[model samples]
Target: MTDQAIIKTGGKQYRVAVGDKLRIEKLTADVGANVDFAEVLFVGAGADARIGTPLVEGAKVNAVVRSHGRGKKLIVYKFRRRKNYRRKNGHRQPYTEVEITGISA
Candidate 1:
């Protein structure tokens, strides 16, 4: 009966609530596809909260994939003083945008 929950995906954890939109690690799901996050760590808040030892059993959060995109590029610069060793690189992490539809706990 809670409105908020914590979910784990792609080695990361996110706090979400119904109708929330989030960008997370890339998934294979296409746009408008349904995705379920079963690794719920906690649900609810205050006195009504439920905390799982590792993951809550029978708890899940449903979402719909809205889009797929990459995050802003990050500059990775490596340099060594007096060693003439310098490297510059850029990275853009792929992510999936999803909207939380419902949470069952």
Candidate 2:
């Protein structure tokens, strides 16, 4: 029953609370699917927080997938000043939008 918790996903960690909306790396769940994050690193509010050695045992985060989409395109360019070499590329990373529904610890 903490106000916030830190959960890990997609090789990254995020501090989140109930009702928070965030975009995370692409997930396999379909839109509107429920997802649970079990790799909780920390939980609780303020001084009451509990931090895990690597991951907290018996801690989890519940969320609902809002959507799946690609992020804004990013342009990558490479050039050689005197070699007349030029290269350009664009990339869009896929992501999942989710809303924090609840946390259990």
Candidate 3:
């Protein structure tokens, strides 16, 4: 059986395995904290397996918080061709990086 699994976090789903590094939306966990996600929307072994109606019970994804940081800054600009209206702005999104330790099904 494969050790890979699909789990949901921060309103998004990710396919992960042990030792995989992934970046998701901003999480409240501090660095070196352990986080477990129990909401498993899908589970499979090889090419065939069981699927949950909503979520599979007893499924979990364990991970460790590696770091907290901000993503690349994005510039937002708006201009009007005929009018003299212009606007420019920059935004940096907060994010968290985590390492998958284990996935159980």
Candidate 4:
């Protein structure tokens, strides 16, 4: 067992510890559903740690999906000088809220 772990999801990596809350890319899970992150890149604490070449075998990070929602809106604007062309757009990225429950290696 380790005190912290590095897990990969949604093309990103996050270093997490137990009871940590984080927002991640949208997941296909309902609120309060248990989720397991199997793509663990590293696990350990202090001087004892295990790093995987890509992913650690038999390493998993357990978490619970707390909620799903959209992030803050972002505005995108485009303009062409002397062309009278203008464009504006807004976007909100979907995300899932999760809490780290446990990490097993």
Candidate 5:
């Protein structure tokens, strides 16, 4: 059996294990920097699982910043049929990639 855990960050929850890479919301850290997430939602080892109320005290998940990049561009278009008005725009959301290093509970 493998050990797995769920952590919350940036208004999102991610189920991850060691050495797993994930792309999430923009974080204020440089590449190769270590970040700790204290809000653990759940953890599983073998057949036993533990859950937290909002967060578990003394529980943390550490990760290393891998890279920062912008996501795919999304086109926004607004048009009115009778008014003959049209607007077009594009947007790209910034994001950060991180690799899970260890989880302690």
Candidate 6:
């Protein structure tokens, strides 16, 4: 069995394996650029598993930035009953799509 790792990025943690694709907080890399994640919290599984005290030394997850885009828009409405006050807002969070290529620990 291959190793799976939990990597932290953009203030969030994600469990990943090779070839897995996910949308995460927008990164500064250009499309098709290689990115390396060094904050690996956990790696492997079963008897070979290793856990990090904050982070596992010499562990890393490699990926390629696929695309950057914003998510679906969300509408937020606020109103004050009987006060004739209302506000409506729309939001779309930006994110980057990435494909995990390799992991080393």
Task: Please name the candidate that would achieve the greatest TM-score relative to the true structure.
Answer: 6
Residue-level lDDT for 17 in candidate 6? 94
Which residue runs of candidate 3 sit more than 4 Å off their true CA positions?
none
Per-residue CA lDDT of candidate 5, range 16-94, in tens? Answer: 9999999999999999999998889887786677888877677889999999999999999999999989999999999
Q: Look at candidate 1 and tell me the lDDT of residue 25.
A: 97
lDDT of each: 0.95, 0.95, 0.88, 0.95, 0.90, 0.97
What's the CA RMSD of model 3 in angstroms? 1.6
Candidate 5: deviation at residue 52, Å?
A: 0.9
Clashing pairs in 2: none
Maximum-lDDT candidate = 6
lDDT by residue (1-105, candidate 6, tens digit) is 778999999999999999999999999999999999999999997899999999999999999999999999999999999999999999999999999999999
Clash counts for the predictions, in order: 0, 0, 0, 0, 0, 0
TM-score of each: 0.94, 0.94, 0.89, 0.95, 0.91, 0.96
Q: Model 6 misses residue 74 by how many Å?
A: 0.6
> How would you encode candidate 2's per-residue C-alpha lDDT over 1-105 as one tens digit per residue?
548999999998999999999999999999899999999999998777889998888999999999999999999999999999999999999999999999888
lDDT of 4 by residue, 3-71 (tens): 999999999999999999999999999999999999999998878788999888899999999999999
Off by over 4 Å in 1: none
Model 6 scores worst on lDDT over the 10 consecutive residues at: 1-10
Please give the range of 10 consecutive residues that has the lowest summed lDDT in model 5: 43-52
> TM-score of model 3 relative to the true fold?
0.89
Error of 6 at 75 (Å): 0.7
- Candidates ranked by lDDT, best first? 6, 4, 1, 2, 5, 3
By TM-score, how accurate is candidate 4? Answer: 0.95
Error of 6 at 72 (Å): 0.4
